[model samples]
Target: MSHLRIVRDEPPKRRERRPHVNHVLTHAEQAQARAALKGLRNAFGSWSALAAAMDVRITTLMAAARGAYNVSAALLVRASRASGLSIGDLLGKPIAADRCRACGQIKRRVA
Candidate 1:
């Protein structure tokens, strides 16, 4: 009788992963986003109207207004356009230095 030999393949090595980072909005930013959405809702006089204006579902707008979920950047841009406010204002940041000339600090460019 002859003894049988078996060959097995080695397992692949695992890759290293970097530590996770928390990118969720802070409490204050969440509140600001919620307030901005709510104000838009109020302006439109109904959730459905606001949703139509934003082209999002009424439930989504409601949840965002109630702070049930983090408001996305695209949603914020829609709100900004409908409200005539800049994205910076929606995010509670001052407008970019170049676009804001009302402060009288930015000099006019000579063309």
Candidate 2:
């Protein structure tokens, strides 16, 4: 009797898209988040220090970064001011999230 060996030959699964939470930040927003995080770190001199200054738990900041949630406008403004980026530059043009991202048509939200 010969022993048979079974091997599973399957490629690793790749997710197409990851849905964001209540606030869906665009890809650009994600990039901005990275810059903002860097600014935040630089302003406070370190991640641990920033957390202390902001009175937020360090884990919260880490989670926000891991999840790719863009900092809120208020946070962005504060970070921009701290990091030497003008508010105008940080905001750029107003980008509304109320439009259908695929076609840019306005859509009403369900109540």
Candidate 3:
């Protein structure tokens, strides 16, 4: 009996593409994001840690924290949910956790 050997060829390497720059945040939005990041940093210790808790990449967190890039509303929603803060809160609104997210009216505690 005779055995045959087969040879496999390696695939061509792909060229590395530069990272895409999608959007840039406005001054107001940037300030809000930075301030929120500051609050989060106190709790999470670092951007990487906060990103892990937020279920997002470190780069995404960094961009949002630094306001170096525009972030999607979805990301904001995720960050708000993860941080237990409303979107307005993350946006630097002077609302407390006891207040309604939209109207900012304080909710009475139920017995």
Candidate 4:
């Protein structure tokens, strides 16, 4: 006589958590990021190229450049190293400025 055996399936494993996702940048910071992205994009000719050179994702680079989200510091270092530029140069200079009535603060454009 032969005996029959039953087997049970295991549950799927959960993915490890990444850094805090939804950490949006401030208005001024967004401006700076966009400006910096412009220069980096120019150098690489495209967001994909830049991200590829930095070993990161194109979407991440695009979002960071468009000010849609903040970039990781490690990515920043990678960009700077890959471009042979300092952090200051990557984050281009400001272009315009205006006073805020609500907070009585001055905001400047980053070019």
**lDDT digits (tens) for residues 15-88 of candidate 4:** 99887854444556557767766667765778888888888888888887776767656666787787776766
Task: Give the per-residue Cα lDDT of candidate 1 at 7.
Answer: 60
The TM-score values for the models, in the order shown, are: 0.58, 0.42, 0.55, 0.55
Tens digit per residue, CA lDDT, model 3, 29-96? 75776677656765667877888888889897787667665666677777788888777778875344
**For residues 1-111, what per-residue lDDT tens digits would candidate 1 score against the true structure?**
999977669766789998754356677777787877876676678889888888899998899889776787678888888767786677674333334424636546689
RMSD of 4: 9.7
Candidate 2 or 3, higher lDDT? 3
Candidates sorted by lDDT, descending order? 1, 3, 4, 2
Which of the two candidates, 1 or 2, achieves a greater TM-score against the reference? Answer: 1
CA shift at 33, candidate 4, in angstroms? 2.7
* Candidate 4 weakest ten by summed lDDT: 94-103
Which window of 10 residues has the lowest lDDT sum in candidate 2? 93-102
User: How much lDDT does each candidate structure score?
Assistant: 0.73, 0.59, 0.72, 0.67
| Candidate topping lDDT | 1
Which of candidates 2 and 4 reaches a greater TM-score?
A: 4
Worst 10 residues of 1 by lDDT: 93-102
Task: At residue 31, give the lDDT of candidate 1.
Answer: 78
- Candidate with the greatest TM-score versus the true structure: 1
